[model samples]
Structure formats: structure tokens, C-alpha cells
Target chain A: MAKAKLEEIESPAMLEEFYRQMLFIRRFEEKCNVAYRLGKIGGYMHTYVGMEATAVGIHHAIKPTYDYMITAYRDHPQPLLLGTDPVKVMAEIMGRSDGMSRGKGGSMHVYDIERGFFGGWGIVGGHIPLGGGLAFASKYRNEDRVTICLLGDGAANQGVVFETMNMAALWDLPIIFCIENNEFAMGTRLEYHAADTELYKRGEPFGIKSERIDGMDVLSFHKDMQRIVDWTRENQKPYWVEIMNYRFLGHGAADNDRQLYRTKEEEDAAMKRDPIARLEEILLKRNVMTREKMEAIDEELTDQVEAIYEQADASPFPDASEVYDNVYTDMEPEKGH
Target chain B: MAAVEVATQTMSYRDAISKVLSEEIEANPDVFIMGEDIGRYQGTFRVTQGMFDKYGEKRIIDTPITEAGFTGIAIGAAMAGLRPVVEMMTMSFSILAMDQIINHAAKIHYMTGGQAKCPLVIRGPGGAAKQLSAQHTHCLEGWYAHAPGLKVVAPATAIDAYGMLRQAIRDDNPVIFTENPGLYTVMGEVPDDREFVVPFGKANILREGTDVSLVGYSRMTQINLAAAEKLAEQGVSAEVVDVRSLSPLDMTTINASVAKTHRAVVVYEDWKFGGFGGEIASRIAEESFDDLDAPVVRCGGLNVPTPYARNLELECIPDVDDVIAAVQKLG
Candidate 1:
């Protein structure tokens, strides 16, 4: 229950950028849904429509070049916010040759190592220890860098999470374990899956500093994350933050039976706390922008996104010969066997 | 077998492995070892004895009894440019960390489009030990070798253990270096040079012959060699081929020997059904079919779980007598 003074977002430029980035993620996911339905993109597609604040808030706090970031499969927004080209990400989703992973890894495995984003791991809670190791590397090399490992509420219950948390605390690794608690893990809610329901408290037994933050508010999330990032970098210790948020869409594009688990009324009530709309309200109340200017910015971004989608669509698919590439670094697999 | 004359020393397989690990840690600042009971208790099999005292706690870490956690942490560390050698206590315990080993460590480099390299080694004694029962013993090298992004090595001799382990630590890929508990006390002459690293994907011709080929790795290689010696006394010149590395299997040597002998018998301690020996047998049949005088015979462990009784245990895994019988059947 630690509190930071709730002040107006101090920088007008920063607030504007935050609003634009969240909107861009929202539109980007919407486009992804459309493309998935249109058969342009294949495989499992988990959109980050409602959890934009969580990815942007924490990522903005870390130095992208130095700090490391790793997350679960619902990961398109993270790479995009970390400065990965949207075109390449989109191409990856479409399984084209120009994709970030050269179409080898689809939506669930977007990685931009240059920007310090480790991966978009498919298994739940699988990357927790990896995140600790990334921090261990930085600490071992005496670098002033921290790693942020983001997992969903579902993954918070995995045994590896506790195992990794214990080791991270023991070694005093510089890393943050962020749980994006979007209420439900696929279809099971946090109440049914977690015994305590307080996800952040899981790290308490491991002696890691823990916090529960309101992830719906971008400014507050960003502020809290900046403090955690600073503390982690200076102390070289692990911290756990549970960002209480909600997913605005189904677990994946294929989860058409989402209505079976929850009702439309509940969904409507949750949407009322939409992060993008909340940011816009703050911007308007503080005279940072008028409604007309905000609408103009959205229009420009929408057109730009549309153009990017077209470019991604037009990009050529990987050649058939590429199926044998990137398997090993030293020897190539025998050809034409 | 290469002659080792200058500056050679007799050492147990366990001590030889420990020596190479010590050397690697001293040579590379980023190299470290971590596992359950590896620090104060030395190691489960004492393979890491004296490492903690020599390198201190920071470099020779002792982890909790959580395989998945430490293995993933090591993989993550490896990706971040450190070379980690993780001891699984027993390869049987490695099942708990299979997701981390097979999914994360093995796939990271290729899945990340070559941006990250997991230069880590997960090593420990595999195969059945005397009266260890079912759960403590497992020859799961075939399971590890099944993965595409991994290098699997099972060294039988003390020298192979020394040279291959050093090479595995330096390799850029994740390697599953399996050791046989049965071979730990077996003595062999290891090269005195600290930098004697044997290259991977090369099979060693332990004994040359012309009648038939006896192929195996790890403890089974020893069984094959013993059978070869007995077969030689019985007027059968058996060519013994030790397939040290199983993944990038030394098919060249296997094929060459099979072609010369015109017959082959693949051996392993794992169950016959879907064992790695099956892969070797299939490769010989498919690639060297034209050179074969008879069908490729395989002598592997029985399909039943390892038993605690000495009599049942002896019946489970292939021995020199079983290998000799298989070779005699081919004749």
C-alpha cells in the first residue's frame, strides 16, 4: 500500500507520447484481429489490447539498450513498444520471410535481441528463471542494468516462479518480476487458479520486495515501475510487482466461446476503465490537448498503421529453401535428403 | 586408439571429468558450476569435489533441490554470455527440468534467429547403477538426442570424458553430456595437456577388426569393447566403434566400419524399444545397406524398468555376454 503523490503528468510531451503509444497498441491489436479473421495471419494470436499500460509503463522505465525484457506469448505490443519495427512484427504474424524471426517464430515468439527483448516464450511461467539468469549476467559482468520479466496471472502460479524468485533473492539479481494479472488465465479466473489470489505476495516468501499496482492507469503504472527499476538497478535485488489489469478481448482470436465464461455486461463494466480513454481524459483535463487535436492524431496514426499493414501484406513469403536455414551455427543439415 | 606416451596420467573417469571442469573454470572467468549438493557436499558422485574450495561460492554455486529453477537460471545465464555447467545429480532428476533443457536452452539460439547462444552443459551420470532401482536410473540420452538443437555426448573412457567435457564447455551450443556411474572408477590414461579437447561428431575406433562391427557409447561402449576382446579370442575380428557423440552421430566411422566388417551390432543400456540404438541400426540399414552381409543386430536393455535385485538388474541391461551372443548370432 505504498503511495506516490498523484500529480498531473508533469511533461506534456511524455503524456502525449504515452497516449499515442497506448492508442497505437490498441489499433495494432485490432488490425491483428482483422487480419487473423481475414486469413492473412495464422496460428495462435493473443492480442495485447487491454494490457497496453502494463507493457508500455514498465518498458518506458528501463534503458532499452542496456536493460533486458522478456515476456509470455501475448507479446506483440512489447516488441513494438521496445522499438521493433511494426512492419516486421506484422510480417512475422503473417508468417512472411521479412518477419522479425524470419517467419520461423510466429506471433508467440517475436524477439528483437538488439533492443534487449529476449523473447516471447510460448510456455506459461517458462521464462521466469531465464529472466533471473539475464539479470545474473548483468550482475556478473558488473553492469548497471536490470531485467524486467513479465508474466501473466496464470503463470504466477507456476512452481518455477517460486523457484526462480527464491534464487533471484538469494543471488540478489537485478530483475523485476511483473505479473500482468488480466483476471483470467485463458478461461480460468485468478480466484479458481490461485489459492491466495494476491499474486504479488507469492514473492514475499522468497524475501523479494513485492507490490500491487493499479495497471489501468498508465501514469501511475509508469511512476511505480520507474521507482522499482531505480531500486533494482541500485540495489541489484529482485522485486515483484503485480499489475492488476483486465484483458479487453478473448484469450486468443480462436477463443470464440469467451462468452461462455463471462457475460457481456461484465465486459462492458470493465471496458469503462479503459486505459486509453483514461489517459485521454487526463490529457484533456490538464489542457495538454483538445478533443479535436486528439482525434486528428488518432486519424493520422490509423492511416499510418493501415499503410504499414499493406506493406507487410505485400512482403514476400520465405523461400522454400529457407526451411533448412538457421538450424545450426556450425554445420548445415544435409541437403535434398 | 591414439597412443598417449608423453605426459600421460592414470585417472578415474570421475576425477578426469572433475579435472576438465576445474580447467574450464580457471581458463574462463565466465565459467561456473551449479547444482544440488555441488558445493559443500562436493557432489552427488564427487565429480565436482574440491571445486567450491578452489573457485569459492560465487563461481561454484550450490542450489536448492529444484531442477527446473536452477536449470532455467543456468540457461538464462548462458544466453547472457556465461558458460554454465549444470549437474543434474542424476539424469533421472533431469526429467523435472526437461522443459527448460529441451524447450528453452535447446531452442533459444535457433528460435531467437541466432541472436542468443545458450553455451551451457547439463551433465551427470546416466544409465542403471547396481541396485539403484527404477526411478534413480534412466538412460534418457535418446530423449535428449531426439531434440534438434542439442548436442548429446556419452563418454565411456576417462580420456573421452576429459577431452569431450572440455570441448562441450567451449562449444557455442547447449550440450547434454551424459556420464555412466558404472564407469566413474574405471581407470584410463588421460592426456596431461590441459587443452586436450576432443572434437565432436567424430567416433573413435577403439579396436580394429574385419569380421563385424560392435558399436556403442557410454558404459555400453565398455561392454562392446569387452565383447570385442572375447570375440577376438574366438577367432572373430570385431571392429569396436565407440559413438562418443550421439546427436551429430559419428555415422562416417560407423558406416566405414560396417562397410569393412559387412555386419553391425548396435548396443545401448536404454530399452530396446525406441532407444537411440534403434536410430543407429536404422541408419546403418538405410545408408550402408549395400555393404551389409547380414541384418544389423541390436543388443539393448530390456523393456522392463530397472529392478533392485542384482539378478534382475543383471538381466535388464546388456552385458558383454549378451553383446557376444548377438555378434555370434550375426555369424
Candidate 2:
């Protein structure tokens, strides 16, 4: 059964907003993939095609100002969901001067401190302790701010993750550890990698409150996440949320080899459980939105994506002279002591 | 009349660090300390004693035994506009936090193109102590000094500890304060004025001499000074220059000293291979090659894992004899 909040939020306007944002993220990512294919975007291009609900659902769980978020390399949706303009995010993926990072950080290194979204770490399980540290500071400062550290199922096996979980439990720091368990990390299955595949139960030894949710259902994700986020903010401790999700595409644009490791039958089965499809089903049944309204929202998003790509394409790259700036503080060392 | 400021009486290195932390914490709202057993337990070495009782629990946080986790937290907090003072218990433990130190703290400013600055300090006791052995007894300040992003400070005296720590806390970049366990109890006079902040990368000349320039940091600075005193008795004037900050190295002062004295001896307490002394030697040899007296001499601990035995621990580190021999060899 869904929670009261899920039942309460039956407004068509809200549904339209959700569809708009989710469609914007999906279209922007698709544009980036095309841009990368056309050589306009360089380096890695990891899209969030089918995992929009995990980003959209969790984005609704906590206030952006009070919560810090750190994610792994598959990170396009986070900046978008964290109040970043889809166009600027698209420009950042294109590596232009007008990008959020001023063209310095590509996809995996996006940082927007103003929105409390930390950089996208390329190293696996590396930012677990980092997120734990941010929460420690929040508790120390007596601020209600909590850090939401997102990692893949692959990163769950890292020793530092276990170390951070133990420490987070010991310190009672406010942090929400969300594992986007998309079944396969690149190519390896969760069960193929670890003996015990369940991440929520893995937190039992550390005494961290853990939960498993059907990540494909946006309502279930939002409701379940609210409980964990509330528990974290109230108790000022760590909580683990393992979101069982699936990515519709390969790991990156370059991985067109078609992930043969996982069966197509499994992929099709998970696709039928797609988050967007599930949300549309609920919206239609509730009569909050029709197919024509949903189509209009997507069309508006497609135009928005096109406008962003055009702006990003025309935007200049950073001049070579700007390379040496910002390595250190503006203040020079004071004269002889 | 300017009140002839009485030099606050001599204080131990431990007390000096406490006083520095006290004054800085009082003056700056940006500063706070975090580490395992720092609060309530009042720090394992008692460096943070009475801080919890004075400043309350929020400022002096006791974290779980997670160096990497807590260190990353400090780095992120630093990025988010708070100056955090992180204690690692020992330099050995800092290895676990290297990802945060190297990747995040060091790279963020450059990686983010000036949108972020990590005004953070990671400090704790370092170097060989009795019976702690292989893991705990290693002096790895050189490892940190090897990094380009961090400002590495290894204060040798009570005054330097007090002054450099204040400077480090105020620095806009990340600083690694490497306090040696061996010298934490050594007593010296520190300025009473809380405004005293020793600038990094400036070598402090403990003794002016016409003979070889003896360069060292932290505990080895004391050993060099001791050897200099011994040499003074035998009519050999040893110029003791403490290279306070290792990263923005005071190569200018070192090169000038070697140009005048015509010879130099570099000493450290870490393993000899890729030791800090090796860097010093290369710098001097490269810059002061024409002004030759003898080859640049290097002295450091033997290349081996530190043992638990007291005598072995003592043997593993460079002593006054080793300093004297290096000075004699330079001559």
C-alpha cells in the first residue's frame, strides 16, 4: 500500500511538473548522447534513460539546501534534479565555457556547491566516507543538513563503504546512504559480484536503519524514501536505502556492444516495470492526466532540450590563458615573517 | 609605553598546541576539531583536553574510528564554507584518508576552476615512538609533502608548533600539520600574543654558522641542533635551518645558505628511499652545484619497518651521531 503523501499528491499540475522534469532529463540525456556521437561532446557520456524516477522520486524526499548529494559517474540526472538548469547541465556535458563548471569539469566531475550537490566522483565507493564526513560537519555545526551519498551496487563491496557505515552509526551523523542497485554494475550482476546481494540487510551489522524499495515505482520510492529521510533528520543518524532500479541503455554511449552479460529476457522484464510507464499508469487510472497531456509535456521538453543544445553548441570553450587560474587562493603569501 | 610584552613562560609542545587551538577556536567561528576519541575522551594524547568542557560537544566532536570517512567529511565541509581542523591520530592513519586528501582536497580548487576552496587542516602526531612499531611508528610526512595540492607543515619547536598551526588554520588551502610524537613534550618559549603566525616556506635559522648548513624538520631539527651544540664545543659551527613547510619549500633560503657555507647536510626521520632529504639534496645539488665544497650529504632512518623494541626504535631513527657524521662527511 502507498503512503498518505502519495495518495494526497493527486494534483494534475504536480503530475505535469513531474512529467515535464523527467522528460526534460530524458531528452537532455538523449541530446548529449547524440552530441557525443557527433563528436561535439568528448570523453564519457553516461545517460539516465530509464532511471528518471529514482532521481525524480529521491529529489522530492529532502530539501536541496539542507541535504548534500554525492553520486558516482552515472550522474547526469542528479545535477538536473538538484535545481540545475537542464541547458547548463547539457552545456557542461558538451564541455563549453558557459557550462556549470566553466568547462573545466566534464561529466564525471560536475560540482555545483550553491545547490549542495558535490562533484560526481569517478572512483568507485570513494565518496562514501566523503558523504559521511559532510554529515559529521552538519551535526557538528548543529545544522539540520544531511548528506545523501549515492553509490552503485558495485561500490557496495568496497571496504571504505563498510568503514563509513560503521562510523556513521557510531557518530549518529545525519546521512542518507542511497544505493541505486541497478542490478548490473557496468556488466557484472550483483549476485555475480557478492555472495549476499542485498545491500539493506548488509547494513544490519552496523546497526544503520536500512530498507529495500521497488525503485521502478515512483510513488513507492517517494513514500519509502520519506520514512528514511525523516528518520535520518529526526534521529540525526545514518540510513540506507537500496533502490532496485534498471538502466534502459548500456553503461555509456560507447558501450553499444549490447550488455550480453544480462539476459535480454531479464532486460525486457525490467523494462515492463519501467518507472515512467508505472507512473503514467497511476496518473491515467487516477484521471489526473491523459495521453495527449503527457505527449504535450514531452513535446515541450523536447523543444527545451533542442534550445539548450543550440545554446551549448554556440557557447565558446574556455581560452587557453585561463588554464593557470584558480589553482590556489587569490591571496599571496604575506611578505617576510 | 608599549607594555613590554612578557614572553609567556616556556611551555611544552603539547600545551603549546592546546593553547594555539584554544586561541584560534576562540577567535575564529570557522574552526572546529573532529577525530576519534577527540571529545569527552579529550584526545588520545590529551591535546584536546578541556576543549570539550570549554567549547562544548559540537565544536569538539568525537567521531567513530573512520579516518577516511571523517577526513572526507572535513574536506566537504571545508568546500561548503567551513574551516575544519581534522586530527588523524597519527600520520600512519592518514594513508586511509589519502583519497580525500589527494583527490578531493588537493584537486577540487583546480578541478572546479576556482568555484571551491578547501580551507581545511588535517593534523596529528607523526614519526617513531616507543613500542608502537611498524604501523603506528612510521614517519610519513614526506608522503604528504610529495603531494602538490597540500601545504605540509612539520613544526620542530613549541614556538613553530604554536605559530605554524595558527597559520595553517587560517590558510585558504588545505594544510597537513605533521606533529612528531617524539617532540610533543619538548619545552620552549612561545610568544604570549595570539596574533603570532609563522609564514610557511621560510626556513628558521636556529644558529648562524660559517660551516655546513644543516637542514631538517620536526624531531630531526632537535637532533641537528643538539649535534650543532656538540660541534660548537669542537670548534665546528653548524648552521641549523628548519625547513618549516615542506611543499612550498624554502629553496631560496637553502640555496643562499649553501652558497655562503659551501656545503650542506639534509636530515629526515622517514625511510631513506624517496625520503624528504632526497628532495632537499636534489634541490641543493641542482641550484648550488657550482658553489661546491663537498657533495650534498643525506641522513635519515634506515630503510626497514620500525620494530616494537625500544632500542630498535631508537636505532631506526637518525640521532646526534648520524648528524655529526653527515656534517663531518660534508666537511
Candidate 3:
């Protein structure tokens, strides 16, 4: 995707906002990594280090607090962009009482029902049909809302994904099937995992208007997503769009052996196209801010992320009395095993 | 209980469920039914016959033969404030959607910290028919009851099925409503009132006796009732306790029966080794050991997969004779 000319853009400040959002996510993920090492965050914590552009683009494209969204385990950035408190998100990761999910869901299961973000589902391709269902309800109730369902390239091969797309197209549900094709299904490379590596074509046989695009450039990605969202909203149809990107961190906090699948040479090549650096260059060319000013802002965001971690760490763990809570809304399960 | 004057009519088990489903769909705008072959084709079991003509396409949505997809779709719809009744062609087919049902439907409320509730009902016929063989004949209420966030109920009679189906539709959590295929044609008196709703976690004593407690649910309850008749002929009074709901298990009623009877025989059509019957038996041993005059015996289905042949299928399924034999062994 070619960069839009600065003259063609109406607001240059939005570009600066995009840079800051990506930078904050980067710093927040880095802090989560340190917290994981320090035994603060538990379970499989997947960071949004390299895929910030995709999430930022997705976050900006939808109607805040109106349109629905659902994604797989690697979820944090989208909710943060949608105005979820960073302290609650961090507290959820650290398994604290006042966290997003009362510390029961941990890192992979953040949910903000008030914001219309359905969940942070852990099962791969599990939430795809759920996304379709949200849209199905929207259309069923004659409501004007779109649901964006995100999945990984690995989850692309799940049978439920195809099943959902077929129904979404057949029923004309207002939903966007967004595939974050980051190329690695856990550790297995895409070429080895998928029969046909062109993941977007999975929706083509169903006659969905599908396309593959570059998700690295946040500005272009946001514009393209906005167009897709409007088309689905107006037409009440489903669109399958594959956002191609890369993950800079390991698959999760525990993935230490990088040599098993990828090489440093390929890693260096991907790093050169670092979305944060590329956006930073755009900001500099446009005179959004000087290098010193950017450094100061980065320091400020770093300190802000540190405070988020500390505030989350200070939050108390859930009381033992709540272990049986939420099992059912009105009834209790046979308590204590 | 006050003896209020209410009209009751005899209806088939299938019609009882259809009556409740139609009533709920008409009563609540949010209530809808979705499944494969449930629209124009009715249902594979014909449980939804004529429902499409009444509700039209939107309410009685026909889905692709994708259990996981539609199941998850129903869960999502439930999360968004719709009450969806998803009919599995057979409870055996629910295995294909276990990940969605157990992981998604069962956990959405708890995992989301009470933010989302999956108010959906997954209902269909279960257990062995004449020739469904191994794959099609599965009593899986035992498995669903094991999940924390799910409500599993297998009603044996048409009245209980009618009353419980209403409660399951109005319930705000995920419910696994399993009806045995063998009992769909069984006729019984069901109340005509739409207000009739059965509460869960309560066991019903079908027959009052003192010798032994014949405990079962779903189709096994019918078998236990038949066994009670034979036990009565032998001058033994066997108390039949029908465990309607399995998840929020009502030990109060069950242990009360065992306490009165002093001996118990848990009968289930599910495999004997790891079935929910074991849970009941263990609970009785732990909580009612002092009341027992004999050991708690469990007469569950044979461990092997049910065969297609008439004789072998009969061998695998626990029947009245099996229940009687198990009660005899309780001494």
C-alpha cells in the first residue's frame, strides 16, 4: 500500500495521534513483558508489539461504543484504543480484583460489554462464528451496527471459520471477517500450515467480496478499513479482509526458542519495516514533532506504562469467596469441588 | 402445594416440547429457534414440525449443517440479549460443537465477569433408539453436567419435559436439555397452562417405598419405574427418585430418599464407570453412610459402544431387568 500524500490528508494531527497510540501500545507491551518475567502477569501472555498498526487501524475504523468487535487471545491494544482503562487492562493481566474480568479471565480474556467489545476469546477460530452471531443479531433486530471479528492466520484453517463465512454471506449479515495473518500459527510457519497460503481466498468460494491488504501502514489501513466498515454497514453484507503483518515478540511470553522456525536475517528484514519506525518517519517528514520532542513523549509514555503496572500490582487479588461467583448469574454451582 | 384447578391433556413427549417452544417463541420476541432442517423440512426428529409455518424464516432460522458454527452463533446471539433455542439433530451431534458449547457457551458469563450471559438452550433427543448404533446413540447429559457454567437436565416424562423446557427457555444461563429418543412417543398428562414452569435441582419421588431407593433420570427413570413394579410384585417397596436436573444437583431430595429407604440403586443409561451416577453414588456414600443398611449399587449402561443389532443393543442398554438385578445386589 502506497502512503497517501500529506496534501491529500485533511487533518495532519491524526497522523501524530496514530504515532502516539502505536508508541503507547509498544511501551505497554514492553512493560507487560517485564511484568511477566517478574512473575506479575501469569498464564500465556501474548503481546501486541509488532501488530499495533492493525489494531490501531481497526480501532479507528469502527463506531466507538456502538459497533461490536471480537478477537482471539492476542488482545489488549484494541480495547485500549476503544477507551478501556489501561489500569483495568493491566490489572486483568496481573490477575487483580478490580480488573476487567475480575481477574478470572487473565490476559487472553479481556471483555468490555459496556463498550460493545464482546470478549477476548482464547480458542482459535472459536470467536469467528460468535462474530457472525453478533452481526446476525444486529440484522435480526434491524439495528444499524457492524461486527468486526479478528482471527490469526493459523485460525484461518479452522472449519468453523469457513462455516461462519458461508452463513454470514448467505444471510447478508453486517460483519467484517478480519484475518490478522501474522504468518505464524503459534510456531508453525504459514506455508507449512495452510494448504493455500492466500488466506483471504478462504472467503472467495462463498462469493464474499474479499481482499488482501498491507496492515503495516496505519494511515492507509485505517482508510481501507473505514471504507469496508461503511460498505458493510450500508449494504448489510459481510467482507473478508486479510491484514498482513508480523509479530515482533515471541508467540507468547514463554516462546524462547526463536531459532526453531525463523532466522535473524528474516527478523532483521521485518524489523526494518517496523510500523512504529515507519510512522515515526512520516511524523518527522510532516514536522509533527522533532526527534527530541518524540524522545520526551516516549519517556512520558514509558513512565505512564510503569505507573499502569504499579497500579495494577497494587490492586488486591480477588477474595476466596468469589471463586464460585459468576459460574451462573443467579444460581451457585456446587461449591468447592 | 395448593390444588388449583388446571386443565391437563395427554400429549406425546415431542408435542410437549413443541408446545413449550411455540409458546415461548410467541410469548417472547427475543425467543427464536435455529438449526439444520428445522425450517421447511421440519426437524430430523420431526420435533419442530409445523413450527416453520407459524414463525416464518426469521424466527425459525435454518442453518447450514455446521454445528460448531451455528452453536457459536447462537451463543453470540444470546450474549447480545436474544434467547435462542438451537436444536441438535441428535445429542450425538453436540460432540461436534463441544468446544463452542463447553468453552464458549459455558464460560462466557463467568469468564467475562458477569458482563455477558449465554441464555441459549441446546436441546435434542439422546440415548439409544432401535438402530442408531454407536455414533448416533449417546446420552451426553453426564458430560454437560460436568461443566460448571451449564445447566443439564434430562426429563423423563412429558409433563416434566413440558415444564422444564419452559424454564430452560427463560433461563439466563446455558442449558443442555436432553430428551431420550425412546421417550418421545411416550404419552402423559401435561398441563395446558403456559405458566407451568418446573424448578431445577429438585428430584421427584415417582413412587413412595421403603426397601430401596431406585434413582435415575431421563429414560433411565422410566426403567426404574418399571423395575419398581416388579420389585413390588416380589413384596419389595422400591422408591423411585427422578433426578430431573443434574448440574445444580439437589442432594437434599436424593439423600432424603436414601435416608428413608436405607439402600440405594443408581440406574443410568450412560456408561457406568465415569457417569454422573458415580457422583450420586459417591455423595450418598459420603453423606448418607449412617443411613445405609446395604451398599449403594449403580446399574449403568455397559461400557462397550452400543451395537446395531437388536440383541446387542438391548444388552448395552440398562433396562428394567438390569435395574431389578442391581436392586437385588444392593443386599
Candidate 4:
């Protein structure tokens, strides 16, 4: 996958925006890690530390309301980029009342329905068909909206993914099946699971257009995703883009047995292609911003993230009386079942 | 209740359910049906016969033999504001899509804090039919009812089938509507009104009596009614309660009936152990313990997978004799 020229972006402002978004995600994930260690956040916290460029690039390329997005559990950065309030997202992670899902769904299931962010489903490959269904709705309603369904390389082997890919191709549903192939599914490496490691080619059997891209390069990711999104929107067809990336942190907050599966040397080598650093270098080479200015922006984002975390931490927990709420919309559930 | 002068028409259970689905599709453009053989072949049992010609292929979609895929798609469509009624070939096949039905469709609303509504209906025949062995014959209402966010409805009579299905279609939550293949050919009077809807969490007292309360749903409801008739002949008046909705269980009606009758026998087609019948028995023990004159007896299918042989299958499921025996033992 060759890198797309940065000149494709007409404005240096857009490049700076991309850099800022990646920086925000990196800083936000770091804070979530600290908060998790301090017991401020509960449940599983899957950070998006290393895959910032892929998250920022793909999300930035799509129409926020017109295009739908569904992903797996590693999903905090996607919602943040899609315009969910950072404070509310942090509150959700902290299990507070003012959270995005009112503290009902912790870090794994951030949902912003108004923004067309479907959810971060907990089950692997569970939302692939759901993505097809969303696309089906768009086609049925005579709308050209596209749905981008994201899954990990581990989820690529799920039978339902193939099932959905076939149906999406047969119906020509406007969807882009984006596989965030971060090499390992939790601690299990791709080689141990999949016979064919070429994740994007899995769609070939369904006759869907497929490709692999360099996920660490923000410009290449953004350009390819924009093309795929536009093609899907115009043609009402499904496509596949396997974003080759890596996760720097452990799979989840509790996955401390990383040394059992991977080596420190491999981790260091992968982090050398750090998406944030690459984007920062690109922005500097293009004279988008100076090193001091970038540092100032990072400091500002750091302070902003800290303030958001404090606000979330200060928010009240959901009232005990409200536990039964939202179980069903039209009926009052039996109390104390 | 005053006697209303509304005309009723007799129809098969299958037709009653199909009528409600067709009516929903006709009334709402967003409503559609998808399942294997539901479009052209008009369903395996002919429940959707002629629906393809009437509504065209777009509305009556015939999906590939992918239960998990189509089910998840239907949930997605429901989230996108389309009312999708997905038909599983049978309840047994729904196991393949359990992740979608249980994990996704059932929890999407609560997980999203009520921002997303999965207004989807997964309907199909359940329980043993003829000699369709262990793999095909599964009464899974108990499995589905155990989930909190799902609405489980098993209507026995033609009228209840028609009315409850209409309600399920209009409901803003995911509903698992299980019909009995054994009841599909059973003929009964259903209201001709298209707007008729049976509300959930409400049980109907099919026969009013004051001795023992016979509680059941789906095919077991029919058996309970038959048992009630037998008990009547034996001078033991038994009230038959059809628990149409399982998840939002009509415990109020069961409690009231048990309070009057003072004896209860919960009958179901599911196995005796860990079956939905146990839930009813426990509820009765908790709520109407003081009102009970005798221990709450449960009459359910044998603790075995349904056999292919007719006699063995017959012995496996609960019949009218089993219900009567259980009620008689409660004496």
C-alpha cells in the first residue's frame, strides 16, 4: 500500500486538524489508562493509543450524519472523532449519570445515535450484519448513505462476516467493511488463527472490491477511505478496506499478560512507526506547524483532557432508583424481578 | 364485561398470524418480512402464501439460509427505523443466531440507554411437531424469556395469535414471537378487525373456574383447556390461564386466579427442569403462597430431547392427560 501524497489535501489547516485529532485520542487514551489504574474507571477499558491515525482518518473522511459507523469494543476514539462530547464519553467510562449511555454502557459500548455512530458491540463480528442492515435501510429508503462497519482481524474469521459480505454484495448495499487488522486478536496472533493472513482478500469470495492500506499514514488512510466512501455512496455497493495497524497497549485494561505473547523488542519496533509521531513529522515537513506550536497544541489538549476527566469524575453516579429505567420503552418492568 | 356485537371469522392459526403480518405490512410501508422460503414458496407451512404476489419481492424478502446474518441485519434495520419481521425456519434454527438475538437485539436498547430501539420481531414455529426429532424440535421460549430486554409471546388461540402479532409488530422493542406448529391447523374464531391488538403482560382466563388454576401458554394452553374440561367432568372446576406473554409475564392474573382457586398446575411443552414452567411455579410460590391450598405442581415435557418416533415424542411432550394427572395430584 503506497502512501497517498499529502498534497491531495488542499489546506494545511486540515492536516493540522488531523494531527490535533490524533493527539487528542492519544492523550485521551493515556488519561483513560491512568484513570483505570487509579480505580476511577470500571469495567474493561480498551485504549486506542497506537491506532489513532486509522481512527481519525476513517472517521474524518465520512459524512457524520449521512454515513453510519459500527465497530468492535476498541471504540473510544471513533466516537470522540464523530463529535460525541469528550466529557460525556469520559463520564461514561467512569460510570457516571451524565455519560453518553447514562453510565449504563461503559467504555466498550459508546453510542451516539444522533451522530450515526451505531455502537461498539462487545461480541466479535456481531455487528457486521447489523452494518449491512443499516445499509439495507439506506437503500430501501432510497438514500445514498453508506455504512462503515469496523472489525478486528480476529473478527475477520467469524462466519457471520462472510455471510454479511455475501449479502451486502448481492444486494449492493452501501457499506464499507473496514477491518482494523492490528495483527493480534487480544493475545492470539493472526497466524495462529487465520490460514490466510491477507485480511482484505476475505471479501474476494463474495466478489466485493477489496484492498489493504497503510493505516499508520493518516494522509493515505484518509484519501483511500474518502474514495471508498464516495464510491459506496455513488454506486450503492459494499467495499472492503483492511487497515494494517497495530495496538501499542494491551488488548484491554486487565490484559497484563502481554509479555507471555509478545516481546518488548517487537513492541518497540511497532511503536517506532507511531501514528502520532508520523503525523507530527508530516505536519512539520509540510510547514503546517512548528515544533513549539505543536507542543503548545499538545499541552492545550492535555489540559483539556484533564479538565474533562475531572468533570466526569465529579459527576454523580446514576441513582439506584433508576436502575430499572430504559429496559423497555413502552412498559414499566416488574419491580425486583 | 358487556357483550359486544362484533363479528368474528373462523380461521386456522397459521392464517391468523399471516393475516396480522400482511395487515401490518399493508398498513406500514416500513414493515416487511424476511426469511427462507417466506417469499416465493410462501413459507414452509404456507403461512405467507400469496404474500409475495400481493406485496412484491421487496417487502417479502427471501433471505439465504443464514440465520445469524439476516437476524442481525433485521436488528440493524429495526435500529434504522424499519419494522422488520424475520421468520426463523423454526425455533431450533434460532440457536445459530442466538448471539444476535440475545446479545445484540435484546440489549441494544438498554445498552444505548434507550437511544436505539430494535423494533424487530423474530417469529417462527416452536416445540415438537410430528416426528421432527431432537435437532428440529426445541421449545426455546424459556431460553428467550430468560433475557431481560426481549419480549417473548406465545399465542395459542387464533384470536390471540392475530392480536398479539399485531401488537408485536407495532412494539418498539425486539420481540420473540413463537408459534406452535401443532396449533397451525387448529381452527378458531379470530376478530376480523385489523386494529385488534392483544396487550402484553396480560393473561386471559380461557375458562372460569374456582378449584384449580391451570396455567400454560402455546400448545400447552390447549392441553390445559382440555384438562380443564376433563376436570369439569370430574366435578373439579379448573380455571385455565393462557400466559401469552412470557418475559413480561402476566403474574398478576396468575396470582389472582391462584388466589381464587387455591391450587395451581403449571403446564408447558418445555422440559420440566429449568423450563419456563418453573418460573411460573416459583412466581406462584412467592406471590400466592398464603393463598395456596396445595403445593403448586408443574406438568411439563419429559426431561429428554424429543424423539423421532411418534410414541416416544408423544411421551416426551405434555399432553392433556399429564395436565389432568398433575392437577388431580394437587388434590
Maximum-DockQ candidate:
3
Q: Model 2, A1-337: lDDT tens per residue?
A: 4556555654677676666767777888888888888999888777888888888878888887558888878888888877777667767778888877778778887777778888777778887777877787677678888788999898998888888888888878798888998887777878899788877898888888888887878776777787788788888989888898898888888877554777788789888987888888888998988999888878888887899889888889888766656656743331232
lDDT of 3 by residue, B215-245 (tens): 9999999999999999999999999999999
* Candidate 2 chain B lowest-lDDT run of ten: B107-116
Error of 1 at B264 (Å): 0.7
Give the per-residue lDDT digits (tens) of candidate 1, residues A1-337.
3332334434788888898899898888999999999999888989998888887898778887679999989989888888889999998888888888788888999999888888889999999999989998888889999999999999988999989988899989998999999999899987999999998888888889999999999998898898899899999999999999999999999999878778899999999989999998999898999999999999988987898799899999989878766666675544455
- CA lDDT of each prediction against the hidden true structure: 0.90, 0.84, 0.92, 0.91
Interface RMSD of each: 1.3, 2.9, 0.6, 0.7
Q: Judged by lDDT against the true structure, how good is candidate 3?
A: 0.92
lDDT of 4 by residue, A1-337 (tens): 2234445563788888888999999999999999999999888889988999898888878888668989989889888988899999999888999998899999999999898999888998999999989999989999979998999999999999989998998888999999998999888999998999988888888889999999999887888888888888888999998999999999999999889889999999999999989888877887888999999999999999999999999999999887888888877666774
Model 3 misplaced stretches (Cα beyond 4 Å): A1-10, B1-3
**Which order, best to worst by lDDT?**
3, 4, 1, 2
Per-model TM values vs. the true structure: 0.97, 0.92, 0.98, 0.98
Chain B TM-score for candidate 3:
0.98
Give per-residue CA lDDT, model 2, range B180-217, as digits (tens). 88888999999998899999888888888888899999
Model 4 stretches with alpha carbons more than 4 Å out: A1-8, B1-4
Candidate 2 matches the true fold with a TM-score of 0.92
Number of backbone collisions per candidate, in order? 0, 2, 0, 0
Residue B109 of model 3 has an lDDT of 90
